[model samples]
Target: MEERKQLKKTLKPHWVWAIAFGSAVGWGAFVLPGDWMAAAGPLGVILGFSIGALLMIVIAVSYGQLIQKLPVSGGEFAYAYFGFGRYHASFCGWFLTLGYMCIVALNASALALLIKFVLPGVAMQGLMYNIAGWDVYGGEVLVACIALITFAYLNIRGTSISGFMQFIFCLTLIAGLSLLVIAMILHPSSSFSNVQPLFNPEIGAVSAVIAIIAISPWAYVGFDNIPQAAEEFNFSPKKAFKLIVIALLCAAATYSLTIIATAVAMPWQSLIAQETVWGTGLVVENAYGTIGVILLSISLAMGIFTGLNGFYVATSRLLFAMGRAEILPRVFAKLHPKYETPFVGIIFTCLITLSAPFFGRQALLWVVDMSAIGVTIAYFYCCAVAYRLFSWTSTADTDVIVSPAKKAMTLLGLISSTGFFLLLVVPGSPGFLGTPSWIALFIWIAIGFVFFMMKRKDFARIPKEKLDYNIFGKTLESESISSNTTKKEA
Candidate 1:
């Protein structure tokens, strides 16, 4: 069973870096810069993201340690199991599932939005219905479905193919974005003077920056993805930390540059304040005409493509991990006989993502808001696990000698992860969920509970040693937890 569950080891170091960087710099950077600027202004976005990246680097230290120890497909899911046994693993797995799937779905829906912005009236051919004050269109849904299917196939074909494509996409995306920033610099009308105000007036500078800081888990969610594919790395797993940090820095710079590029194209305040769906697109269109939009299109397409490709990989591996543990249906654990990819898991994710476009563009925000909560929950689990592993005082199995500095980083990771969680759930908080988002979040939690209950009996029957083999490929009796309780979950 363990052998059957193993995935191919074809992912190169550069390919791994591309997965993290490419996934982190997704549709959100291009499409939501104006919204971010409206919420926190240009300087706030820059400072907020830079600081957020630093915090994520702290978290990445925990991930690096855990990945070096476990080096599995489940990433945080396996880490949670190693630290606190099965129940906490379930909690981490279920929530991270939400984070990964929602991002995948969001990117697919974003593809439709990209089409709507680029081609305009073309996707409006068949008006399906009105959803969240946004019109649902059949043409848009079809386009999103096709894109989803194409990415799903690319993944199912083999990681060698998909991983190679991700590298190419990352290169093109960086080059295209570099061109956008350069064009903004040379444009006659573009000026740093436009970014005069650095804060949202209503919220104040401190509050606005804090708000952006709170969403760090969501913004830098994909860097954690390095661990998700760590098991597939063709290079040393020890290099995972450096790759994650490198990706976080690059992603932060990309986000800041994109926002600054938009602001410098015209007046920052006026561009963001305008009632336009695609404010950055409008800025480029007005300033540089079709040439600008065409340039923007390359970046946008690569962003969306990389997002779809990357998240699909993360979500599938997670489901595959959970399925192998029998927390989910065993079918999810199945792999393609030929490609050795997680085809069942891939197909399952694709099927779920297919419904996203039908909900219309506005619905994507609700999912995005809700996913922050999920990823933040997973972040807390990962950091907490790392803290225990490092701070374990028992001399038994003291082979893992962690430095004081590394231990301090894990503590900071815990604090920052907790802060991220509080921001999302706290009422009137900057990252608090709206009514629609709360509703979606609750429905997902309820479904997870239902699945847990239904599988409770079957899971209880599995022996702990067998469960360990299914998940980590061996019994982890040495991977002891430092917690007070020794409760085990099936």
Candidate 2:
């Protein structure tokens, strides 16, 4: 009870939106646009993202309903726990946890590469070795390690400080993108016709859109992070729902404009042919020279930081939830006496992130694809759980009411998420994830299976009375009473 009182609710409504939006945008905005444009062409990429946004909207509705209804820290895990059962909940939470860690690793590699890009020979001076064809450097690895530690420390200190940093980084990214778009519009050399090839011959129009859709989940994965921090929100649960929707919409717009600006500045064919994947930087350099590179690089830092920091917060909370439930080791549930943060989880996550920089960027890209698969599966499961809850709760009085329209939306989310997952693994689909991605997915699943066997007894029988009832992580008397009622009903 004393420990529950230590977890404070300090995140404001706006901060919730900022963190979600910022996390969703991430380093993908700057790096992946070139590939997205190449795969789907400018028009096709835009159309695909629009379609993707609609699909996400459906999923967001389900998440909104669940978050408001549960108002718990473990977002997806909590939904699965209440709707399905402990065993299913652990599976859902474990997969999402793996997905979040993959993303954190992805961001770490991206950060190291970005440092090498901006700093040049400074980090690249000593070629430590080679991994998967990319040259590894001790200095670059050091930079990434330092960054990982910094983010972990920030989160360990407290959520309030971390949330504030997220807001600032998000604003900086928005400002940087705004400046670039304005500059592109004003450039005398720029042309709207540069986006001419709406679909490329190599991937075709349908395939292009499908490819974008295949990766869309990762590009917009941050909205789900909102629910992980639900216990920290200061406003009503309904506001948290609205903020998620708003954040995704904003992310969709930001991505479209960023792609358009890049496309208008440089032809898609030219970008595809570039030897380096730093297409966004090259486009900015083409339009505004060194000044543009510097601006975009700064924006890139903000984008990368948002994903790194937001996911750091998210993955730790996830570990905390699982640990508290005795699904994972209880060490993950340990909180700092002074900060009341998940210090053990944070450190464990940081140690995992330490591996990504060594494997280099290409390896992390495959890891991101694998992460997308896991996230898609988790989304599919959550949609199933959400739909079930909608049916079961009709007669129950709950804080979050699911209307007929919301119910329909949840069904739509289930269909779309299922379809998206199929597109990833289906044999003949245009967006069939490649061999490496599948291999990675299988390996992750195997590891999870091993862990599950070790905890089989706990999974077979969960102690509902022993479960933490302070959904908001607060020790209010009313919350304890409500929790008891909930456990009794269960």
Candidate 3:
């Protein structure tokens, strides 16, 4: 008897891993913590980083478990459909798509800032002067727009090209981090005293922790992005799980080292007070003079571009999945025959991302705050679903086996996500506004819900079997078929 091999359609494992790492190392490393530090100081940095990392681990583990079960392309949307229902799924999809788009824009803007720092005279005066007829912020916006367009074109070409670009950028980013770390180590005055707290304010500890949690969530936001690459893993789920854990460990180490280096090299107060939030260049310049600034600037530019590339890829996929499921217009689902990529989605995302420059600091802060709330909401849903899945599965099922250790991790994740969610909703806190971001989120969610209801009939037309398999699992196939048949008759 001749046996046939099941042909697998998937992305290379290395690319999947690279995307996960690249996604996490975005503007969050430089900018996210700075915002937190501004509110909390050096101690705040340590507190924020530790708490954020812990919460992220929980989110990541829950996501990892969910991916093993579903392994779909839509990330949270897919998870929500299975765990909750159509309404929640659509809400998550729309919210996550918006967040990713905003992140792309944010990274692009940061890249422009980096360019201005590197070549102050040429990049600033020549570029900004010619484009907007103003010497405003060195024309980084114009440069960012150009870079966004170029990257969008490249991404529209294929995932392989985008992955390659991320690898290069990741390397450049490492080099930049290395330069800063070395400088801090070599400098005599660099010490831990700057970050060491003499006395913890008795009254403010709880509030400070809450504030830190709200802003720090940004640093660990992208760890959940790994599950989105489930369709790309070449190995078994077990191996993929191990890989993610290892990668997270590495990321933690990298972040911890970078923070230590930054703290040691610069006065905590000075670093916090600096108007320009991208402190890597300043750290470098402080250590190695002019040459350090040039190197750091180049590295920062590459890192921003790489992060933007990741955002583009992730959001495009989310849009593509929404289109495929008919939650979005079918036009967004169109893939370029030659490129085998979602061309329309990419173009749309890029165009929307260009709005970053017009958004001043206040608007930018609002966008970030709103996006963070949305992401935290999604994380909460994911954790809740994980808890349910763990509880509902049969004890004897190999696939559903829940170790004490696994359960503990999942529990911790759920707690952290829930706590953070509550923190975000509380008003008058440092680094967060309760009602504004929540109101923004509600408006977005309402829009999605309205669209879902309008298309409810079309969604109904989809075979219940498909919906069930898509949302729940193959294990629920029989139930799905029965339910759909009954609905049809009704």
On TM-score, the leading prediction is 1
Poorly placed runs, candidate 2 (over 4 Å): 1-6, 391-402, 468-490
Across 443-479, the per-residue lDDT of candidate 1 in tens digits comes to 9899989988887788778877787888888876655
lDDT of each: 0.86, 0.80, 0.66
lDDT per residue as tens, model 3, 212-284: 6676556555556666656545666555555566555545555666667767776656776686546655776
Give the clash total for candidate 1: 0
Candidate 2 structure quality by residue, lDDT tens digits, 1-490:
3244334788888778888998888888887778777778887888787788889988888888778767767888877666555667788887898889988887877777787877877778788777777888988888888989999999998888899999999999999989988898789988888888878777688888887877778789989999888877888888876898889888989889888888888677888898665887778888888898889888889988999999998898888887777788778777898998989989999998898788877777776787787788778877876775554246544433456776788899999999888888899886787788888889989998899899897655654544544233433234333354456546
Model 3 TM: 0.85
Q: What's the C-alpha lDDT at position 431 in model 2? A: 75
Worst 10 residues of 1 by lDDT: 481-490
lDDT of 3: 0.66
Descending-lDDT candidate ranking: 1, 2, 3
Ranking by TM-score: 1, 2, 3
Instruction: Quote the positional error of residue 166 for candidate 2 in Å.
Output: 0.8
Instruction: Give per-residue lDDT, candidate 2, residue 21.
Output: 90
2 or 3, greater by TM-score? 2
